[model samples]
Structures are given as C-alpha cells and as structure tokens.
Target chain A: MAEISFPLPDLGEGLIEATVLEWLVTEGEMVERNHPLVEVETTKSAVELPSPQAGKVVRTYGEPGETIKVGDPLIVFEVPDDTAGIVGTVPKEEAPKRRVRLSANLDED
Target chain B: MSEHTTLSDLEAAQDNTTAADVQQESVQNFPEPADAGATETMSMQQALNRALAEVMTENPRALILGEDVGQLGGVFRITDGLQKKFGEARVFDTPLAESGILGMSVGLAMAGYHPIPEVQFDGFAYPAVNQIICQVGRMNYRSRGTLPMPITLRVPSFGGIRAPEHHGESLEAMFAHVPGLKVVSPSGPNEAYHLLKYAAARQDPVIFMEPKSRYWQKGPVNAGADAAGYSPNGSRVVREGKHLTLVAWGAMVARCLQVAELAAEDGIEIEVLDLRWLKPIDAEGLAASVAKTRRAVVVHEAPRTSGLGAEVASTITERCFGTLKAPVERVTGFDVPYPSGDLEDEYIPNIDRILYGIQRVLEYRRG
Candidate 1:
C-alpha cells in the first residue's frame, strides 16, 4: 500500500490562502499528475490547483467551502507498491546542494 | 507652661510641612512644558517636499525616483524644485512603470543604495504590486542574509481630491497584506516631516502614503534643530478626553481631531488617536486608551468592506473586550466602487460623519 500526500502549491507572491470554489474530481477517483484538481478563488482572480502526483484518491482533507494552508495536505493518493519507493527518493540531478544558504537578512532585526 | 507652648508649635509646623510636600509631589508628577504659542503654515505638499529635502541633505545615498519626479516635480508639485536642488543624480525621473520602479529599487538596495520611489498616484500602484509582493518584500529572505533592501516607496493616496479614477484610491491594505513591508501614513505637516526622516533613517522598506487633499491645509511644525516632527512608531493623542476614543490615520486623522473639537462644544469629551505606523500599530497605546474610554470609533477613507478599519476594530475588540462599553464603530467610505471625484465628498467620511459615529457609540447600552 503506497500513500501520497499532496500539499497546496504556491498561488502567487502575496497570496496566503484561496477560497475553494469547486472540486473537479470525486472521492476514490484516479488523477494524473498536472491535472486540474480544484478551482480556488483569490482576491484577484480564480485559479486552478493541479495534482502533484498520479494515483488513486484515498481521502480529501477539506470541504468545498473550506480554506487550506500552504502546506496542508489537500488529498491523499495510493500509488502502485513498486512506485512507492521512488516517490520519497530524490533524483540524482535534483538533490540538495551542500553549500546552499537559507538564512534570511530579514531575521537580523 | 513654656514646654507645652513649644510642643503645640512643633505639631502645627509638622502639618504645614506635610501639606507642602503633597502639593510639590503632585506638581512634579505632572510637569508641563512651557507652551510657546508659535504657528507656522505650509501646505501638506510643501511639508512633504521639505521633509524629502531634509532627508536627502542628511543622507547622500538616499535617492528619489518616480514619474515626473525629476523634471516635472510630480503632478501636484510635491517634489517641485527637488531635482534642481539635489541635482539629477540624486533625484531623477524613472520610466512610466511602477513595477520597474519597485524592481529596480530592490536591485539598487542589493548593490547598497536606499531608493525612495514614488508611485504617481494610489490607483497607479497596482502595476507594481507584483514586484512589491514577490521580490521586494521577500528579497531579504530569498537572498539568505546576503541582502537588505532599504527602500521607501511614497504613494499619494485617499479620496476627496476631486481627481479621476485611479488617482484617489486607498490601497494600504494591499501593501499591508505583504509580511515583509512596513506601511505608514502621516496626517499632518508635523508627521510628514518626522515620519519621512524616520523612514530614511531605518534600514527597511517603507510605503509612505500622503493624503493629496490635505496638501494645502496648514498646521504648526516644530522649526527647532530637530526638524523631523516626532517619534515615528508612537501614536499621538491629538485631543485628550475621558469619554470615547477615535482612532484614525493620514487625512482622516485631521477629521477625527475636528470631530473631537466639535464634540467638546456639545459637552462630550473625546480622545483622538493618530496611528502613525499602520503596520505594527501601537496596539498597547490604543488598547489602553480604549480600555479607559470603553468606547472606540475607527475612521478611515478606505472602503468599509475589508478595509484597514476592520483589522483595527477586531484587534481592539480582542484586547479590550472586558472593558468595552459598546461595540466598535467605524466611519469609512461606502462598500461600492470609488465614486467620481465630484461625489467624493459624499462618499468619504467627513467631520460630521465621524461625529455621528462617536454619538452612536456613546448612546449604545452594554448588557
């Protein structure tokens, strides 16, 4: 049994949350990667949230009228057992850099 | 007989000393500054221009950029004669793009320069929203301790100027939504002077909004050695009273003060609070005042729906709920699209409107 948890993606620069306008898929449905999963309404305009992984939907965390945070899991996916091992592992070209700095100048104050 | 007379005299002397000490203590506790009745008059626009000049002279690296800022000195002449005085190098004009102005300011700061870019009007600042929200607001964090963008963007905002659409808009909430930026607006000439100096001195990006309609309005400004008016972060109690508290900023603050004066004539004492720093508001001062008064009326020229007044009202309700005598009232613009310039007087909150809000708050009964 492989489980996939998809977090909310970045909508825009200053947008923190969006209103869930409508859901495109139902429970227990299969969804492919990059497919439009939900339509979210922001202060500026309405935007579509895309699926991050290809799998069968196991659970949905929020209702249509609810708002979710940036890192909150929107959906849980059950993928093939064989592909489960590849989900958590980083690709050779995309591995984290050793010298990358994450400290922010804003923290000085 | 001689010993009895001396004892009575000593008791009387002791009582006199105690009474004198009590009087001295009270006077010392509330020492008043010598009131120098001196008045100076200058338009709000002229005051802002003077503030920019003072800051520019104090700091060589401080630069000003905006459409018409260089040659034209702004549509209202707020920056008039600045380019000639400071030279084009320090106060030059920029291309007609707000995003470019904000983005370039971020880059300039990364290269060690303080850029004070002006958005020609409140409505025109929307084009630069992308850069402000993404790059400028988060550059300090994205650069990972490598950069500090100390930029100040001046936006002339609010209605009642009889200008066209896009000219009179209160978009402070949009900028306030960004986490990394500081938003501030000055209500008078005195604040115009000190707040600009404070913005220039600080090492953070600041969006300073100036009320265009109050440009010609005059008030007393300290002409002493310390030119910059007063403390930037602290809230000023323009009018003191014990009844209700009226909170306002920018141009609306003047209207609040006026209402306080008018209310005084009707035997109602009202306290007016000027929130100099919109973000990181002086919550302590406001809450304390509201707790004392037990009634609050928040005022602003922005639309009432989801405006800055809502945030202020919520915070006050949360902090002073136990002491509040009535529900918080707000005097603001209607929730419709900003009306034409001719009808702005009816749309924006005026002195009479604020007085009405105060009366409503005072008349409410708490269960």
Candidate 2:
C-alpha cells in the first residue's frame, strides 16, 4: 500500500500557515476523497481541508492548537491501489436483509 | 563589481558625459549570493517567490492570501508555484475584490497569524484603500496596543513596459502618508527578496511595493538570510558620490543610477540613495548625504506637485537647511492622470528628464 501524505494548502492568498482546530477522523479510519479531514483556522475563517485521496488513515501530523505551515505534511493515507488521479472511497457493505413487497394488497382485499 | 550597463547611448542625445558615467569603476558591490550558500540568479519575481517560500518554510504563522495567488500563481507569477508548495489552505486565492483581500488579512492578523496579502497591481489597489488607509494603518492604535496587526501588503507598481491604465503607477507617497504603515519599494531583485522577508516577519503593516519595471531584472540575493540581515525600516545607498544627492524609490532608483552615469560625464558626482523604506524614511542617512552634497534631486513615477519626491525634498530641506547650496529639485510625472502606452515614456520621468533635473540642481547658486 502506498502512503499518500497530503500537505496543508494555502487556504487563502497571502496565508502561509494555519492552526489545526480539530481532526475529524482518528488514525486507521477509512476516508473518502473530499472528506473533511481536519479543521484549520487561518485568519478569521475556519475551514476543513478535504482529503485528496480515499484511503485508510495512516497517520496525522500536528495536534489541536498546533500551527502548521502551508506545504507541511498534515495527514498520511494508505491506499491498496495507489492511483495517480483522485480516487473515490466506497464504504463497507452493511448486513444483508430480506425485503417484503406490497404490490398485491388491493387484489387480496 | 558593478554589473550594471549604463545608457551610454544617451550621451549622444545631449552633450553630456553619459558615456564616462557608465564607465566609472566600483559603482557598487552587489553582494554575492554564494557568500551564504545555495544562491540563484533569479529575477525580482523569482526572488520574491523564494522569499515567500522561505518565510513560509520557517514560520508557521505566515500565510499568503490574495487574488490568483493560488493555482494561477499570481498575475506576475511571483506567487506562482507557492500555492502548490504551501497548499491551498495556506496559499489560497480570493475573490477579485481588493477590499475583501485586505479585510480578511486584517482579521487574520488579529487572529494571531501574520498575513501577506497581494494587492495584484498598482491600479487595482484603489478599491482596498479604505482597509489599507483606515483600518490596517490604525488597528494597533484602535485597540490601544492590545492588537498587533503584522500585515504585509504586496503591490506591484511603476510604469515603462506599457501596461494598462491602472497597472502602471507609483502610489508610494499616498500609502507612505498613512501613519503606522511602513512603505517599502525594492529597486532590484535583492531588495525585493530581503525586504519582502523583513516585511513578512515584522510586527507592523508594510506597504511592500514591487517595481513592475524591474520585475524581470535579474540579481544575486542570499537565497536564505536567516531573517537577520536587513530590517524593513531603513534606506540603502546604491551608489556613493559627493557632488549631489539623488533620492528615489522603487523603479526610479535604478533609473537614477542611469541618470548618475550621464551626470558623471559632466564631472558632477551624484549620490544615488534608494529609499527602500519609504515611510519613516532613513532621514538620518538622507540628511547626512544631503549635508555633504549641499544639493538634492527627488525622482519618482508619481505625479509631481505632492508626490513622494515632494516629501523627500521637503524633508531634506528641513533637515539640511544649514548645509544647503541650492533648492532641492524634483523630476516626476506630470500632475495629471497617466496617459496611454504611446505617451507613457514622456509622462513618466525617464533618464533624460532625471539628467535634466540633476543638471538644474547642479546649476543652483545661492543668490
């Protein structure tokens, strides 16, 4: 599995760094691309940086209240098949169950 | 050590010694970048980019926010490759509104982060004048020193390459007039690199004006200066002389050097002082030089009447009145709106006009 390390981006122009407000998911959690991974505060606005890839969270850098510069590695994601372009996440399957149909209700009455 | 090529051809136009001036020895000692290690012969645009990148690399609190600073890498490409290197969260773009860019910067500074917002162009900065002139300049005072706003406003200014109406201008005097703001305009790539780093790491708001004319001018700069070499508060003497003092900022500084080459042929040693820091100008340095020369000439791309040149001339007059030989002169743009590209060369102070101003000052006699 390839570990994709995503760096913090310039949330806005002239902004070089941001303070980590919170991490949305714990390490080892499965995440999809565009998922809100972390909330960072730069200037007066607080924004969540979306995950750039769908993968199992390998590790996260910095803690709450910690400041991180743009380009500093923030989160690492482990992917089974490391795709070059953006890869979407598919959630795990739920338990299988039977369904009942009510299409003949009027004829039976 | 001077690599600058003076306009020797200009001497042919007027019967002055422009050729001899350009041939003078030891004009200046532009520091070698390798003295510190890992230097690049980058242009002003690239130098500024490296400074922004280095500052961002060192300080987690420094962030860049502006229009097209991200993805597009800024209009001048100064901020190009920064967004990708820093991340969109830290090097992101903003709306086209000028006020919005600066307004957010003020808020960001108050939130305990240092912000460097790019105003894009000289003309585009007008919309953000309110935030820059009123709030950004007075925030520390308004909060009674409780709030410290360390915002560096990056504005590309000056004329010569025939840019559109608003893009070509030198509004340093307007911003320098605002109290609590440090106005700085770098003449070349080195100052652009060092000054931007100094401005970004300071505790006050700085109007960091980049000379558009010299954006492509290449020079060697200590790629990384441990943020220790220069402070964004003083001037630099680009060339040393004794006959008279030539005070200029931004693009005009380089032009003054060319003007000096012409004046040298006439046996007039012109001292070229680059007011890198416009506001809180190096009055002491300027006074000392003007005192020795007993003559002065101020140059800028702004309209005359009440531009930066006037301010410099007045200050020198006030400080060096006892050692005065003649009235301080000013060579500047006409007191009207800038004309189109075809007429810009004439409207802005070229080397010819500057040479004329220097000659006029040299002829000054206390009658």
Candidate 3:
C-alpha cells in the first residue's frame, strides 16, 4: 500500500483558507473516487471537496471548527499501487486534453 | 465587504459553451397571449416576477439568464418559479458570470430572441460594463439598423436595505449617459409590470432598473389596462399639488410623495413627478410642472456632485427659465461611497432632506 497526502485545493474568489464544517468520511473508511470527503465553508459559499480516488482514509486532518489553508494536508489515504501519483486539482477521470472548470486554471477564451 | 471580485477572476468561471445550449431558434414566431388581465394588488418585486413570466410565456424568444436565477429563483426571489414555469431550457442559470450573460444576450437578440438578463445587483454591473457600454448599447449603431438589438437588462438598484457593499448602488446615471440605450425606473408595482413588458416588446435596448429598496412595496396592477395606466408619456403625476414640482424616480418616488404630504401640512402643495423614463427625461412634462409650480426640487440617492439631480436641475433651468419663480433645488446623497449598515439613513436622502430642498426652493426669489 502507498500512502498519499491530499492537500486542500485552492477555492477561487481569492479565498486562502476555509473553516471545516463536516467530515464526510472517518479514518480507515473505504471511499470511492469523487465521493465528497469534506465540507468546507468560505465567506461566499459552502463547498464540498470530492475525493480523488478509491482508498482507505488513513487520517483526517481538521476538526469541524478548524480552518485549513490551501496547500495544507487535508486528508491522508492508503491506496493500492494502481492509484499512486493521483493528486489534487486533477480528478482521476480527467484527460490531459480536457479542461478543468476550476476558476484559476482556465485557459484563454 | 470583502474585496470586490475582479473581472479576470469572474471571467475565469465563464463557460461560453452554454450559449450553444440555447435550443430555441427564434422568439418572433412564438404565440401571443390573448388575455391581459385587470388590476390585482401585488408588491413591486412580485409584479416584476409576473412580467418575466408573462413575457416568457408570450414570446418564445424571451429568456432569462442570471446567477441563482434558475433553481434558486434569484436571491430576491424576483425570478421565483420562472425556471419551473417556463422550463430550464429557457429560464436557465448561467455560471456566476455577468459579462458572459450580457455578451451572449446581444447575439441572442440578434437571432430574434428577447433575453431579459438580470445583473443581480447594482455594484455587480461594473464587471459587465464592457458588454453593456460597448456591445449591447451600440449593437444597432455599430451594425447599423440592420441588427435591431432589443435586449433588456434588469438591474436591482438603490439603497435603504442596508445591504452589503457592492450589493447596493445607484449607477443609473452611467447607463443614462449612453445615448442609444433607453433607461427606465419604475416607482411601484404597476409601473414595474407594464414597463418591463413594454421594454421587452421594444425594438431597442433598455436598462430597466428596479429599485430594490421598494421591491416589497405593494399596489394594484391591471395587466389589461396596465398599458393604459402607464403610457411612457414622460413621468406620471402620482400626487398633485401647486407649491412646487417634487421630482424623483425609482425608490425615491415613494419618499418624495411622503415628503410632499409633510410639506402639504405646512400649506405647500407639492406636485410629485415620477420620472419613469430617465434618459429622454420628461423635459416637456417637467417644464409644464415647473411652469405651474414655479419651483422644482430634483431628488435621488446618488451623490449630489455630477449626479442625475444636477442634470434635472440644469434641465429645469433650461426649459422653465422665465416661468421659474425660484432656482431649482436638489435633494441627493453626499459625494461619498455608500456607507455600511448603520450609517445608511444618513446616506440616502430622507424626508427631512427633501423638505429642506422644498423649503430652500420656496425661499428663493427671482432677482
């Protein structure tokens, strides 16, 4: 098994950190790809973070009241060898040619 | 109260492919509704919602697009139930994108669709200024009359709600300055209903401003005789008096009427003029009112410096020159950023400020 650390993704509108509202998964819980892993709230709207791959949640980082900064570890997952190298921003199903809809990484119109 | 969202940041989330999702070919071919009902009391916001529903129903070409306008039914609920009533294919939400929504509307209008795109709030309009000022406002002239761009931009405006910064602003003068566009602000529900329908039916672009402050203010609305009630014939004289012409528009109209009643108690008869059409202002009607009253007080929530109040005052001086018994007076907000929550009362022109204008105008004598 390979351990993978997942950092908080940069939520747009210049929000640097967000308060954790709820944890959708507990440590050692098996989760499928794109399952909502955590609910975090910024000033404008509440957003749910989707897990990148199917894995056993090794550890969860923050309590409900804690604030997590972008690029900080949010969760740790123990994944099979096939799921290694999968990381933040890029969901498992995304292709190199396909454009992600995140606000910051948008290519020119 | 956070830092304003930048245009570049806003532009990033815009999905241009949504324009292709517009399935309808044209609105000109849509069937017209036979029944235009009689008077029913409703709030200004409710009347606006009804207007969008009726227009969407009658003209297959007319569609509404804005943030939270679809499933959320708008933050103000002005577009409440429209998406369900008309179908999401027509009344759909766009990405939290203003420029994208407004820019696509010009193309839709060119393709024979009447797109009633809402900007959500006044401060939000700045992000779409390029689309509004450069594109839709000049589509006809830029392409000649060959392309009759008839898009209606709905903006919820004004203060008194103590809303957050950039959420409440009075930027109508900026729109009114552009020559090719029509600027309209309805004082109450009846006008909101009729003027919206009229602007939708119009062949040119119109900036239909709704005073958010008076959104819940209720009054009768007769859809059939609605057109008969509001003729776009220069402001409606909602209250009649002889002391002076108390001119105001949007949310300020109700306030001016209240101030007029207060002045009446002091034996001053104030004629309240709701300048519904702010662009080609009711110069003739205003002249007539001023000639009759011999004094005029222009009121608005915008800053006094370079505000539309100054324009109204200048216009009165120009049209009602010899007949004017006194210099035109103005009741307006101070030249400062719209203050936050508790400081709103001191910002918006209240009844006392309006009364001061009337009193000042009354004291003036032609020298």
Q: Global lDDT of each model?
A: 0.73, 0.75, 0.76
Candidate 2: true interface contacts recovered: 0.00
Worst 10 residues of 2 chain B by lDDT: B17-26
Question: What is the Cα-based lDDT of residue B112 in candidate 1?
Answer: 63
Residue-wise C-alpha lDDT for candidate 2, range B1-367, written one tens digit per residue:
1231112322222232122222111112232223445456777877888889988877666788998787656766677677667676677889999999999999877766678999878889999999998889998878766666789999878776666678677788899889878788888887899888877877778899988767766676665544354444567777889888899988788777876766666566789988887887777878878887787988888998778887788889899998877798988899888876668878987777777777676655556
Deviation of model 3 at B188, angstroms: 0.5
Candidate 1 local distance difference test against the native: 0.73
Query: Chain A alone, TM-score for each of the models?
Result: 0.70, 0.73, 0.73
How does model 1 score by TM-score? 0.68
lDDT of 1 by residue, B1-367 (tens): 3322222333343221121211100001111123524446665666778888888777666788888787656766667778878777677789999989898888767756678999888988999999888887887767654566678889887876666678778988778889778888989887786678777766667889988767656677654464432345657677778788999998888777767766766767788888777776677778878887778999988989889898889989999998887899999998887887468878888666777787777667646
Model 3, residue B75: displacement in angstroms?
A: 0.8
Candidate 2: stretches off by over 4 Å = A1-109, B1-39, B225-232
The residue-by-residue lDDT of candidate 3 on B147-234, one tens digit each, is 6667889998888776778766899789989867888899988889888998887777889989877776568887754455346546
lDDT of 2: 0.75
List interface RMSDs for the candidates, in order. Answer: 30.0, 37.5, 26.8
Model 2 agreement with the true structure over A1-109: per-residue lDDT tens digits: 4345678888898799999999998998999979889999998699988887688998999999999999888988776421321211111222322121111111211
Off by over 4 Å in 1: A1-109, B1-40, B227-229
